[model samples]
Target chain A: MDTIIQCENITHYYGQKMIYEHLNFEVARGKILGLLGKNGTGKTTIINILTGYLKPRAGICRIFGEAMERLSPAAKSRIGLLLEGHVQHAYFNIEQIEKFYSRFFPQWKREAYYELLKKLQVTPVQKISTMSCGQRSQVALGLLFAQDPDLLILDDFSMGLDPGYRRLFVEYLKEYITAENKTVFLTSHIIQDMELLIDDCIILDFGRILLHEPTSYILERFRRFRFDSDAPAFPANDILRNTERIGTHWETYSFASAAEVERELVKNGATVSRLSEDKLSLEDAFIGLTGKY
Target chain B: MYTSLFYKEWIKARKLLLLLLVVFAAAVAYTLLTTIKQFHANPVAFWEFIVENNSIRTGYMRYLPLGAGILLAIVQLTPEMHNRRLKLTLHLPLDESKILCSMSGFGLALLSGLFILSGTALLLGLRIYFCPEIVYSDFIASLPWWMGGFTAYLLTVWICLEPVWKQRIFNAIPALCCISLFYTKALPGAYVPLLPWLTVLMTAGFFFPFYSAIRFKHGVQ
Candidate 1:
């Protein structure tokens, strides 16, 4: 796969507070990478830097092998972005908004935009201010997709969307990726919804990446072990980070493969029942890694 | 591409421009009616009518360009700045220079619309009242001077709102120089420096749109 976006040692500061330091990541073409982080964790800031809305205090960021600062007209023309907030002009209707965006992007597809509006059940003639948050989001999503950009950077696309709308949005993302072979970098707090769609994930906390790995690798290596109160204390090993005792049982997470951890637990004179690996959700992994609910 | 953006700006400001034109026409009509009424009351005192009402005429003429220019500048820049659409606009395929130039061109076009309205009033007023001896040529020549000054003032007002150059020299420097040069006879000719100052002001007004366009395009505060 080709690299679409590359950031190396990228540092950004907001006044005296540090947002991100020495952040490095690469996004491959035709892959949907999920940027997971708690609120106010520099996810939007990173998106801003990638889109050239904000300049980093230190280090370099490149999109399509060209420095972000040096993004030529041709390069910018190929990038589509849906900003975090409701960003369309309030006075413009969906149709006017589409027309305005089409002027800026050379490859904008009018037919695709109208088709997406129809698919999302949004009226093109409706004013943005009169539209609900979900409707506005749908329009923004439609506009972004219409650009037909090689890389689509969506900042919290599922924000303010209801469950049904979110599901519809996810469906659109899946369909677009499958049909067009497009690359997407989406940041959302709704981890479960993105679990199936994302090929890879980046877990962020305190402006640092806790983990960057494929979803399959994470599921294969990380295991959750639970034991009853009467069970014997498990033997200490390098794989386990910390163990906590709950009311009548012990729940622990181990970085080792499930089979390896299970074998070690059984050797400690404890009858360990392996929990189904399918039970591990992205939210579980996120909490296990960040220690945040 | 630049023309398309300019056309979009025009569309956005068109309604406001229409309201401005209506206001300008009403004010002009009111002034003409009152001036004609005063003239009918006393034929010999027409020159007094001209002098006493000179300030009013000048104020009315001044208001047209100044009002329209300031209105256009505010309506053009405020929404883009507030909505953060400026960031998206700046990232477009066009150069910052081209975008700004196109916006400024739109502003100038709006200013020209005001000039046309003012010219219509002047011509209609002169034709109806038969003021052949009133030296219309002098007024015509001096109209550009005031237009230049008004355009500069409008431009300065717009630039003050931008995040660049917090000092606001563009906003204050023009007025101060104009006042000092006119009052102190600082240059070779009394009005010579004023002409360039007006030119500079008009030029700056032309650049105000570009300043906003670049600021929007570059995401510079």
Candidate 2:
């Protein structure tokens, strides 16, 4: 896979509190990487660092093989970013906003912008301050899409968007990803909504990465097992973190191969009914790994 | 790129610019009418008026450009700072110098418009009634100085209003000191020379914020 963004040993701190330490990851081109984290988990901070808005205390972040700090205007022009809050200037009407953004981006497509506006049912003459949250998001999305950037970074793009608009945004993103073979990094709290769109997921908690893997690999490896009170304890291994007993039954979470775990359970004389093979979502994986309710 | 940024700044501050223009035009008309009335009531008194109030007239003329500069800077940047749109601006692919240049260019353009409108009204008044022989070249030559003053004032406000250094103490202290200097007659005799010096200082100061903006872009907290 062609890596588009490589973050190596990046550490960031807020005063004395470390937000992220020794973080290493690479986002491959032509794929959508969903960043899953709860509120206050430093998702926005990471995005800020990636976009060169914030500097890390130590280590390097490279975009398209160039250090983010030393990225030229030409390299920056190829990346589009949508911040979490209102991105549009309040005084700017839609037409003015489009005209303004189109100037900075050399690849900006005016026809595509107007087409997206029409598809989103947004009028170009309306002032941004007067628009609803959903409408503002549509405009921001329109601007990003029109930029046609090689790498798109969205900081919680789904926030404040209604269900219909959310689905529409997903469809548009999918189409863009397929049509242009562009890479996307999206951070969102709404994992259920992202389940259908994310090719890979990263679960972040308390300034550390708990899991990073393709969706299919996560489903195939991790299994949640439930047994009666008398079930024998699973063998200790690096993959087995903890086994908890709740009331008359016990639930064990393990990172071992699912078949191996199932066989171990059968050998231990515990009644093993293959629970539903439902895949664990990003949110479920996050909660399971973090041990947070 | 500069043209587009200039256009964006114009759109952002157009309403405030229009309002300033209207007030400026009215002030120029009033100044012209008062001067003409004095000249007609008594020719001797009119000449005396010119001599006695030459300092005041000069001060007023100087204040006109400075005040406009300060007001334009405040109005242009305050909203962007309040809304945190400045961050978005820095994130754009354009260089920091270009962004600052665009803003300064727009301010210069607005200053030019004000000068032309006011200068024309004064000339028309002179033609219609006062007929005072005035050195148009001197007035025209002084425009760049005025533009420089206003640009500096605008750039100062932009830097001061940034979230990082927006301490009330910093803003209030300088204002209080300036007022004290004005009221207590403590302003230095060298202050008059500093006006031209300030004009240059301010013109140069216009680029400082852009440097700071570049530093800000690099995440220098």
Candidate 2 chain B: worst-modelled 10 consecutive residues by lDDT: B179-188
Interface Cα RMSD for candidate 1?
2.9
Misplaced by over 4 Å in model 2 are A230-238, A241-248, A257-279, B41-46, B53-67, B123-152, B165-192, B218-221
Grade the docking of candidate 1.
acceptable
For candidate 1 chain A, the 10 contiguous residues with the lowest summed lDDT are A271-280
**What lDDT would each prediction earn against the true structure?**
0.70, 0.69
lDDT value for candidate 2?
0.69
Instruction: Show model 1 residue runs off by greater than 4 Å.
Output: A103-107, A119-124, A227-250, A258-278, B49-56, B127-193, B205-221
Give Cα distance to truth, residue A39, candidate 2, Å.
1.9
Inter-residue clash pairs, candidate 2: none
